[model samples]
Target chain A: MKGFLLQGKNLSRLRGRLKSALLVRIAVYLLLVDLAFVFAYPFLYMMVTSLKSPQDVRDITVNWLPSGLHWNNYRLSFSLLGYPSALARTVLVVGGCTLGHLFSCSFVGYGFARFSFRGKSLFFLLLLLSIIVPVQTIIVPEYIFFSGAGFLGTYLPMMVPSWLGFGLSGGLFIFIFRLFYISLPRSLEEAAGIDGCGAVSTFFRIALPASRSSVMVCLVLSLVWHWNDYFEPLIYITQQKKYLLPMLLPGLYRIMGGMQDASLSGGDALGDIYTEAVAMAATFLVVLPLLIAYLFLQKKFVQGVERSGITGE
Target chain B: MKLSYSQKRRWSGYVFLLPWLVGAAFFLVYPFVFSIALSVSDLENNNFTKMFFVGLANYKKAFVTDVEFVPKFLTVVTDTLINTPMIVIFAFLTAIMVSRDIKGKGIFRALFFLPVLLGTGFVMQQLQGQSIQSGSLEVARGILLPEKLQAYLGYEITGYITAFFNRITIVMWGSGVQIVIMLAGIQSIAPALYEVARVDGATEWEMFWKITLPMSAPILLLCIVYTIAASFTGSSQVVDYIISLAFGTAVPQFAYSAAMGWIYFLFVLAVILLVFLMMRRPVNRVAQR
Candidate 1:
């Protein structure tokens, strides 16, 4: 009604209002663009700088666009970092973790959602506490325990926890899953009971399929978290062959340059430019798969977040 | 006593929770207990094959005699306190904007949330720290205060501002989850309430303050907690100090490191508990009112 009236009775005012609204919209868009650039420029710089030739990267002026793709930077990184093997190792670790979280955390979530057993609330509180306490606080002794048990230098510390449903962010995943499960109708359980289904069977057959969206959320989160995990691997896995991409990233400049020189982007001198490009290249390699996966799975991820928010469970 | 049907059903719940229970016992509980023991004991070995029980000596050393632990942890805490408001405000404001009927909102959301997909944990800290320092130092230097203001504020404040500008991108990047949560909070508000507000001639600003903000109080509290917890996480200086105390030196004083960790953990726990207590009262009052 306001718009219709403004269109005729206050035509001049409508023009002024439309102009102001347009100006405001343009300003908002500009702000958003600035923010997006701020968020994106780091990775964008990584990709662009990696492709720059040695001379192009080292020049005094900042050049955002590379002259050409320096696929050699990737080739060098691929060979130097043992990219194939490391990528496979990461995949194995991350894959195992996602599976572990999907099955085990969901099982735990089902228990929390369905049960009113003695000490259930206490156990749940403990679960919440686990999420709050910094794992770093316990790492001193935990690391010692692992090394003492000869579990250090292997994937045991990282993988074993996941297998047992206590992996990185496991508490949160279980919480999410429990929220999802509790939202299910009580009639489903009764129906399953009438159909001669046990709790385990019912969960496997009914609840698991029903909570597919949450499961996807857990899978993507677990996969992404495990894939990008640098610290745990840094602590536990000492073997060069076992190092994930991130752990290898800091060392790439050193390995590629074969010099005890400073970090990759040393004083704007030309000497370190090639290594800087190589470092960016190595970073690109590490994050490429994640970027691709996010591009594909972003819809599902957003949906999951929306659902979780709506329930606020 | 013989169990009834409901009793059996209740007991069977434990069977389902057995894996997480056992994992929690070993992973979190046992490690926590071990941390307490290691903190109190007199252990100077790298691995813990050799140790002697000494009551609170490690804690005493960390708390009383330590040249670095308390101050270093406090520095991290201070850093967090300064940065938390900016991150949360940025997240909340951006979320409200994106939630409004706007063009290309999905694109904006995806762009804002890109950080969560890529940057997390130590990798993010290193990437952000190194990238910003080396790549953008010259750009940051352009924003230096004039001579008079710089002199008055001193290098301490001026230098902090410069460094904070360098860190601003990374800090904003940390708000991805918070933004999403707040966005969800906004969307979950009933549209009927908005319609009613519009009928009553409520301005957007008024509606935001009176309705949207108060309605999302629970989520805002969650975001604050997340921000606090995430601040202590990653490669924060506190964690670095603890790690260095345990592993950086030749003779790793595991017990001393454990003490430092416990102290830092207690400090973080206290901050979170305070936030909960502070937020809870207002929420309770709102409920009563």
Candidate 2:
């Protein structure tokens, strides 16, 4: 009878501990969910608010949920925000930047990794300096230089420097690639060379293939940067038609300001308010490509982070 | 050692390096010199030719004349001092937890790392938008309990608390990169060392302090440098403020903005050099270890 009672006590104690552990886990899960919601809520709010009618949005008691769905807000945002033209401009600029980084940075990084030459140390040091030096300080001089060369207001200023393996900071990728290349066995490159491959051919055939992970990392990073970059696009691309997505979204604020004077005379602030909502919607549209890319390639994205040695640092 | 014809491939190496050398000299060096010169020269006339050297004047103006410079610099410094430690702690803790034999470890790792993919600029813009929206919401909701508690601690203390919150918000959004870096560092550490420590009956706390911290010092240094650089470069608030101050309200003329940027650049350079020197000893020690 005593043994039975002790067994019962032990079972209950075990059950209680298990129950508390389960409770703690659930609490943790809930907390994580709450964090995700907090981080994501503002974006959700922006999207839903963008889809609402002007009246619904401006109602005295704001709707946490949209009263009705409106895809027209997207269409309106496109036209009002000059989405098509700006997106094209953005694609061209970002695409150019990515290609430039891919080809030039790889070639330069390979050189730094494999070569022995006079001024090798000095040149590598120069690359490090380029990474550290703030580009803003040189923006004016570069503007003047490019303008003198009749390259200002063209994609040339944004594109050409990158082609020369310049302007990209966080030399971490290039440095990592160099390290990776150095660590790679030289036997394969020698084998390729013996098969009548030159240095360039060996690079293309052997070195490049081996460094795909690092290259992917550089590509994704460069693309994301160019897509979100506001300052350069704002400075270099003056024409409204030439504006990138980031430049265009902010330009909406300027457009709203311009409309302010005209709207006051019309005695209708509704149009202005609606336009502001549309502008916010346009910002959402600009962000969508990146968001989609992130969703799909998140695994590679994390792998890239790890490979870039950012995690260890 | 006797070098065969294939073994002696010196010329080819240089041939491969030619493009980089040319690019650096033309694109990097020339512009760097020109920029330094531009910072010093007085631009009375429109042409680059019509420039006279005015040593220390721009730096002087940045210090004495510019009201925004001091406050902005202080803001950045305060931000760095606060955010750097929090990020380091958060990243280290997260790495340690994820390294443990926990359920759903991969998922937690992935969730913590998602923000790195959403680049700094996008995150900052999102944060700006959110802050503006939430600021209004807090006012309207009269959610002053947290604020009142903060105030009861006294104004300076409350100010720091608020600043700390703001810095953490920034760091949390920005930490995906740092966390991944720290995770990689933690992962690279040999399991045998931990096993040995466990066999020796070392507590988890002792193992972390004795093994994990020292082994990960190199990466920690790298993170510190990267974080500092990112904070300085990626902050739009600072950039916008600098641009506005330099260009006035109407339009950003190229020359004046350039000059103002040089001032900011010099300040940043000094800070970086100081930090680098301070970090050098730990890095050397790590390398030796």
Query: Quick one: best lDDT, which candidate?
Result: 1
Per-residue error (Å), model 2, residue B86? 2.7
**Candidate maximizing TM-score:** 1
What DockQ does model 2 achieve? 0.39
Clashing pairs in 2: A310-B181, A311-B180, A311-B181, A311-B182, A312-B181, A313-B219
lDDT of 1 by residue, A182-273 (tens): 87777987799788887888889888888877887787788878887777788888788778777887676555344314333454343443
lDDT of 2 at A32: 55
Q: How far is B251's C-alpha from truth in model 1 (Å)?
A: 1.2
User: After superposition, which runs of candidate 2 have C-alpha atoms over 4 Å from their true positions?
Assistant: A1-34, A59-63, A194-196, A254-266, A269-275, A307-313, B1-10, B95-123, B129-163, B236-238, B241-259
Predicted chain A of candidate 2: TM-score: 0.82
DockQ of each: 0.56, 0.39
| Model 2, position B75: C-alpha lDDT score | 81
Please write out the lDDT profile of model 2 over residues A187-283, one tens digit for every residue. Answer: 9988887898888888988898877767766776777777777777566668876667777666575564355445556766646554445665776
Worst 10 residues of 1 chain A by lDDT: A256-265
Model 2 captures what fraction of native contacts? 0.36
Best by DockQ: 1
